[model samples]
Target: MSLIEIILVGIGLSMDAVAVSMSNGMVYGTLPRRKWPLAPLFFGLFQGLMPLLGFFTGTLFAKYIDCYAELLILLILGFIGGKMIYDGFKGDKEKAEERVLSLKLIFFQAVATSIDAFAVGIGFCAINVNIFFASSLIAATTFILSSLSFCIGRKFGDLLGNKAEIFGGTILVILAIKAIL
Candidate 1:
């Protein structure tokens, strides 16, 4: 693919990561300034890594991975979304507000969001693109978009108040369902 096409592909791949980053911001409110990049970093890192891994994996196990990717994404996101929904409805505002962002959770989100990218990398095996360059572009795109989205989510969370978690959770569940379909 051409550079423009690669960049466009990166944008397409980053959407889910963007949404997850936004959800994190909404559910957790404004995080510490030092922790601001945590989600995006994981998102970008995994986003980049998965595709490279996929490219290397090639068609060897692409079919097998595809068979399981959707279910994995569904379970991971569904569980997290379910928990957020429960917390939102629990009527414990203090606990909700005090919720800390976990690295493990972010790791899961990154992997969940990047599964499609792995497939894309598999497709890359049939093309003439440079996997490293393409993965880097994809990672950069995810990082920039996710970073901006987190800020947007934080602002909206402030307005949405306690309902933000529910809204975020609903988005995630919808995304999970969408992934499977």
Candidate 2:
């Protein structure tokens, strides 16, 4: 793909990550105060890296992964989305502050959101583009979009109050479902 095309793909690919990051912002209350940078950082890191890894290894590994990729994405994202939905519905407020945003949660969100990029890498094997340039643009675009979306989502979430978490969780679940179909 051309540079513009690559950039467009990056933006298109990042929509889910953007939504999740925004949800992260929306549900920021459940998380700790000091970890402000965590949302965009994790999203951006995985967004950038997954495609690169996929491009490098996809040709050799695609068949092995194709069989299980959808299932894995469904499970991981479903579990996380389910937990968020469950957490949003609970009555206790104290537990809310203590739980959520676990390392495992972060890891899963990162990987789950970036699965499309992995697929893109698989497609890249058939093309003759500059891998580094494409990957870098993709990563940078995701970072910028994810970061901005998180900030905006957080602001809106704050306005929406407690229901924001539920909404965020719902968004995740929807995205997860969309990924598989």
Candidate 3:
């Protein structure tokens, strides 16, 4: 994939992390500056690692699915994006005070958010893309976006929280459709 496409995919994939980071910001907005790094560090690490895990897993079956690579990418991205939009509209409010950003929470959130990327990794294998570069771009974009999301949430509250997810989802869906076409 080209760098632009990789970056777009990264942005699309990071929506879940971004939403979670925003929630974290709302919860931990009062923390001291020194402890602030914890949120981003946890988020960035997980975001970075998930794609690598996916890439390795995808590599194992790369040969078997080479012909249907683009279709697979489209399906995965579309499914993830559609789910996010559906969830956002479901209007299930997570109690702000009840949520905690513990290790387990971070790990689960990271995995949940990046599951689609794992499928994308499978597509990468089929397309013969460089796993290292794709994963690196994904990680970097996710880190930056996640960090910015936290900051934005801190400054603006949840005003844009749902909207961000919707936008991200739309982007992913569009990309998926484009890939398929």
Candidate 4:
């Protein structure tokens, strides 16, 4: 694929990651400055890594992965989104500033969001694209977009207060449904 095509593909693949990063921002509203990059980095790394893995795996597991990718994404994002909604309604009343997002959660989100990219990588093999360059572009796009979305969500979170979680959770659930559709 050409550079423009790869970049476009990167943007397309990064959408889910961006949405999840935004959700994380809202949910973890007062996350420390040092930790701000955590979500984006994890997301970018996974987004990049999955494609390379898929490229290397080639056609071996393509059918299996394609068959189940949507279902897996649904379950992962659904569970997390449901939890966020439940927490929002439960009114735990913990200060947003006191909350810290767990690495496990970030890891799951990253994987869940990058499954489609894996499929794209398999397609890349068919097209004889440069896997490294495409994956790197994808990673960079995800990082930049996700970072911006997170910052935007943080501002909205401050304005929305407890409602932020509910909104963010809804976004994830919707994205999950969109994936299935």
Candidate 5:
């Protein structure tokens, strides 16, 4: 993948974390200044780490799918993007609104949100790109976006809501189609 595409994928993958960060911000809206960055920091860390884990795991089978890499990329990206789009239309109403935060809770949220990045790691292998570069781009983009979302949500609470997911999802789908042509 090109550097630009990798960055876009990072942004796309980050949407989920961003949404959650925003929600979490609002949930923990009353926190002292010192604790504000924790959630997004954890989110960024997991978002970065999960893809690396996935890439290494996927690297184990890279030889097997090398010949079919292009198709595999399409399959993975399409599936992920479609899921994101479907999730977007569903809206945010179904999610629970609760206050209070803990490290365990943050960890749980980070892992849950970064699960998609894990799948994305698998796709990275299909493209035969340097895992480090791709994961770094994804991680950096996720960090910036997640941090912004957390602040926005913390201050504003559920403003953009699910639209962010749809945008992110669409970016993935577009990139997937681009890979094919």
Candidate 6:
């Protein structure tokens, strides 16, 4: 994949993390500045790591699924993006605010958000892309977007509110469609 494509994929993959970060910001808007590092650190680490895991898995099984790799990427991206959009519009907004940022919660959120990147790693094998560069770009983009999401949520909590999730979801779905086309 070209650098632009890789970056687009990263942005698409980071939507979930962004939404989650926004939710965190809304809930913990009053948290002390000292604790700020925890959220981004945990988020960035997982966002970066998951794609590497996926890449290794893809490398192991590359020979078996080489022909269908593009289709697989489209399917995975579409599904993830569609799901995010659906969840954004349909999920319980009240519960989102109530969610606590415990270790277990963070871990689950990280894993859930990063699963698509794992699939993307599998796609990378088919396209003969540099896994290190692609994965790094994905992780870095996710980190920046997620961190910004938190700030946006905190600043516009009352006005943007739950609508941010809807916007994020829309972005994911659009990217997925673009990937397929």
Task: Please name the candidate that would achieve the greatest lDDT relative to the true structure.
Answer: 1
Indicate the TM-score of model 1.
Answer: 0.98
lDDT comparing candidate 1 with the true structure: 0.91
- lDDT scores for all predictions? 0.91, 0.80, 0.65, 0.90, 0.68, 0.67
Task: Tell me the spans in candidate 3 whose CA falls farther than 4 Å from its real position.
Answer: 59-100, 158-181
Superior candidate under lDDT, 1 versus 5: 1
Ranking of all candidate structures by their TM-score, best first: 1, 4, 2, 6, 5, 3
> Which candidate's TM-score is highest?
1
Candidate 3 residue pairs that clash: none
lDDT string, candidate 2, 75-127, tens digits: 87777777778888883677556656666777788888887788788788789
Cα-based lDDT at residue 56, candidate 4: 93
* lDDT score at residue 143, model 5, on the 0-100 scale: 77
State model 5's lDDT: 0.68
TM-score for each prediction?
Answer: 0.98, 0.90, 0.61, 0.96, 0.63, 0.64
Weakest lDDT window of 10 consecutive positions for candidate 4: 91-100
Candidate 5 global TM-score: 0.63
lDDT of 3 by residue, 1-181 (tens): 7889889988887876786676556544545566656666666666666667667786775555544645765676577668656755754566323334466655555655565666677667667677788888888888888888777666644455545445545655665676557
* Residue range 77-108, candidate 1, lDDT tens digits: 99999899899999696887579989999999
What lDDT score is found at residue 181 in candidate 4? 97
Give the candidate order by descending lDDT: 1, 4, 2, 5, 6, 3
Q: Which residues of candidate 2, in runs, are more than 4 Å off?
A: 29-34
Question: RMSD (Cα, Å) of candidate 6?
Answer: 6.4
Residues 66-91, candidate 5: write the lDDT tens digits: 45544655665566557657866776
Model 2 residue 178 CA deviation (Å) reads 1.1
User: How far is 56's C-alpha from truth in model 1 (Å)?
Assistant: 0.6
Error of 4 at 170 (Å): 0.7
lDDT of model 2, residue 66: 72
